[model samples]
Structures are given as structure tokens and as C-alpha cells.
Target: MDTDEQQAYRQLALSGATPMEIAQVAHLHGLGAIEIIRLLRSIFTLEFIEAKELATQAVYGMSLSDYQEKYLLPLFQEFEREGATAQDELLQSGDDRHL
Candidate 1:
């Protein structure tokens, strides 16, 4: 997705647009509906994860650096590593067929 699509998606999503509505707007912009859905899923997933972490920090009095070092950094690294592994597996499996 392009920057404009990202901005529009975030704005519409944060403003409480429905999934179908978001899909319509995204489709009008030549973006795929499935792509919009995936983007929304990713956005909300990150928000959910961050909210849980923030709540934990509030309960434990964890410092920003502590949170980063203990949770955020490791989680991000693991996600990246997992994505890379999945990509490698896909490549090795020769799964070029589109879903």
C-alpha cells in the first residue's frame, strides 16, 4: 500500500469506519479489499498488543527502557525472525501459487 492509502486507512479505521465501508473507500482508491482487511487486522493487532503491554507496565511500574528491553524489543525481534523463517520456508517449499 502507498502512503496515501495507509493514511486514509488509518484515519478511516480510527474514526470508526466499518469494515465494508473501509473496503469501499479502499477499493475506490484502487487498493484491494483483502489488503485493506489485512492492514486493519495488523493495525488492531498491534494496538491490542501494545495496550496489554502498557497495562502491564502500569501495574508493575516498569520504566520505558525496561519495557523496551524486556518485552517490546524481544517481541519485535521474534516477529521479524518468525516472518523471515516463514518466508524462507515458503521459498524452499516452492509455493509460488497465489492464494
Candidate 2:
């Protein structure tokens, strides 16, 4: 970012704009929207982004260590058991992949 763009970011920051809003403006100006969102997220002391409108941008392909260490691991375990049960049933039905 140039001095002018940095000033724009600073102004947006001081105005207390949400991360998503900042990202939209940054996108319009051809800025790095992801970095802008991350910067604002830090400024706002966010744990997880709740902007459903930006859910794809908020967490798409995101592999935050905390998310896996806490939320996803537990959810994965729950689904793993269900998958195991389904696999057993499919095996009884003679799945060719197992053969």
C-alpha cells in the first residue's frame, strides 16, 4: 500500500469499521482484502468471525490450529463414528471397493 492507501486504512480503522466492511472497501480499491480483514479482526479482538455474509472469505480453506485443536477435532470424531457404522453396513452389502 502507498502512503495514501495506508492513510485510507488508518481512517477506516479509526472509524471502527467492521472487518467485512473494511474488506469491501479494500476490494473496491484493489487492496489485499484478506490482510485488511485479518488486520481489522485483530483490532476487534475476534476469536471467530461471525459474518455470515462473508463466510466463504471468513473461513474458506482456513486451517487455524485452534479450530482443529478444539472445534473440528470433536466434530470429526463424531462424524467418524457415523462413517464407520455406514462403512460396516456397506461392507455387509458387498461393496466392490473392499473387494
In candidate 2, which residue ranges exceed 4 Å CA deviation?
37-99
Residue 68 alpha-carbon offset, candidate 1, angstroms: 45
The clash count for each model shown is: 0, 0
Report the CA-based lDDT of candidate 2 relative to the real structure: 0.60
lDDT of each: 0.61, 0.60
List model 1 lDDT by residue over 1-99, tens digit each: 877768767788689975445555655666543455455565555454443443334443464468678978989999999988888888889995631
TM-score of model number 1: 0.36
TM agreement with the true structure for every prediction: 0.36, 0.36
Model 2 root mean square deviation, Cα atoms:
8.4
